[model samples]
Target: DWVTETIVNNGEQYHGLNGDILVWNPVTKRRHELTSMGIRVTKKTLKIQLKMSGQEDFLNLPYHQALLNDEIPLSIGGGIGQSRTYMYLLRTAHLGEVSVTVWPKILKDICAQKNIKVLE
Candidate 1:
């Protein structure tokens, strides 16, 4: 509820899935993503996002089906942490160069746009 509210209220482009804000890296003197966080998806938002990314097939999966069936709460959950931060500090081209995690699609997308790759 609040998550969607904040997203719409902010009126930023592509923020439904990419909600993080960037800070200037004083040492490197470039934009840096210190955090990746935002509201979790509701069923409505989930469908919208899945379609937008052309992964509509995810809807057929059990977890997604449960949400669409209202077997789960309308509210859902955010994250930023050391793994990718280390990649940034090391000035590496890829996060996989430093760490590994299952990773979130939105986060991966943000890093990819920055020319950073993570472990699959």
Candidate 2:
């Protein structure tokens, strides 16, 4: 899938859920996804997302209405660290101290044990 719009928990932007995990290596000059996430749309989520997109006519349909009425099981899905492009590029061991780094004891312990270096 290419450039598919995704939304999460009434989020503003659709983080890539039903899509591929892309990895772009600037040093190696390559882009790839380690794995692909399958269809992750539930009836409840779909209706909300469609409504947000201003396409609520889908709500009138039986399948769509069933979702809104909570007649179907919610689709359990989401992206796995799909939004961590920068940390991957920098080759950092942890994400706690990069954009808004707040170090926890476990992270500190792991960094110490693994000899992982983080530059502030």
Most TM-score-accurate candidate: 1
What candidate 1 gets wrong by more than 4 Å, as runs, is 1-19, 24-30, 48-57, 66-81, 101-120
Q: For candidate 1, write residues 72-116 as lDDT tens digits.
A: 875543124465477577776554657767888998888878777
User: Model 1 scores what on Cα lDDT?
Assistant: 0.67
Q: Candidate 2, which segments miss by more than 4 Å at Cα?
A: 1-17, 24-43, 46-83, 101-103, 117-120
- The best candidate in terms of lDDT: 1
lDDT of 2 at 87: 58
What are the lDDT figures for the candidates, one per model? 0.67, 0.58
lDDT of 2 at 16: 40
lDDT (Cα, 0-100) at 38 in candidate 2 = 58
Candidate 2 lDDT, 20-50, residue by residue in tens: 6777655445564444665556655575568
Reference-based TM-score of each model: 0.42, 0.33
